[model samples]
Target: MQRTADRLLREPLDCYDDGAIEEGDLSVIRLALEQFHHAVADRRAVIGTGSTDIPPMQARQT
Candidate 1:
């Protein structure tokens, strides 16, 4: 999954503008990428824990 995230981050921004995406479309893409980055970070944090260690809870208090 990190590999996929790397690919996403490395991809050319021009690719997203190929069809003249509207402002709303660009916003959506930005949000998606941000979410993807967060998920990748969370996955890495979990995997960094040693086999004998428990993964940390990630829930936020409201």
Candidate 2:
């Protein structure tokens, strides 16, 4: 999950630097934000499951 988050963060930066994503693209930003949220959720889930806190992956946005 941490690896996924790291990848999500890296992918956006890479795309921006490669000119694949425009600076003013809100869609791209939203997608990146969503991916980041997912990664965080996954990490939290892993921790929660390990410690038996809230049954794991129960934390969600919206």
Candidate 3:
């Protein structure tokens, strides 16, 4: 899911014209991405540390 979100964000938006997207639809996309990343981060906060002995801060810094 995180990989999917990353790919979605990394994708080029220039393929679509500015006028092609409605303002409300753009907001929904932004909100979905925000929620997806947050959900991934929240899961990682728990899952990441348990699988490894590394501390969260230290693991991130490295």
Candidate 4:
């Protein structure tokens, strides 16, 4: 979970260089945002603040 958060919140910075972003970087950013949204939804459900329709994110096996 922590790994996922780090990837979503921090890793994207690596995609930037000299204040410019590339197409591949945009794809990475999109995926990270989508995963982050799922994480938030999962947390909300766990705390009874959201519906269960949103499936929980699976931890990646590193």
lDDT of each: 0.54, 0.59, 0.51, 0.61
Q: For candidate 1, write residues 1-62 as lDDT tens digits.
A: 74875586444445444544443555655666667666766676888942333335332232
Give the C-alpha miss distance for residue 11 in model 4, angstroms.
Answer: 12
- In candidate 2, stretches whose alpha carbon ends up further than 4 angstroms from where it belongs are 1-24, 49-62
Q: For model 3, what is the C-alpha lDDT against the true structure? A: 0.51
Off by over 4 Å in 4: 1-19, 51-62
Task: State the number of backbone clashes in model 4.
Answer: 0
Weakest 10 consecutive residues of candidate 3 by summed lDDT: 53-62
lDDT of 2 by residue, 1-62 (tens): 64865676667666767888776753665566666566666777887844323322332222
Clashes of 3: 0
lDDT of 4 by residue, 7-59 (tens): 66554455454345554665666576677677877888889985646555453
* Residue pairs whose backbone atoms clash in candidate 3: none
Candidate 1: regions farther than 4 A off? 1-19, 49-62
The candidate scoring highest on TM-score is 3
**What TM-score goes with each of the models?**
0.47, 0.40, 0.49, 0.46
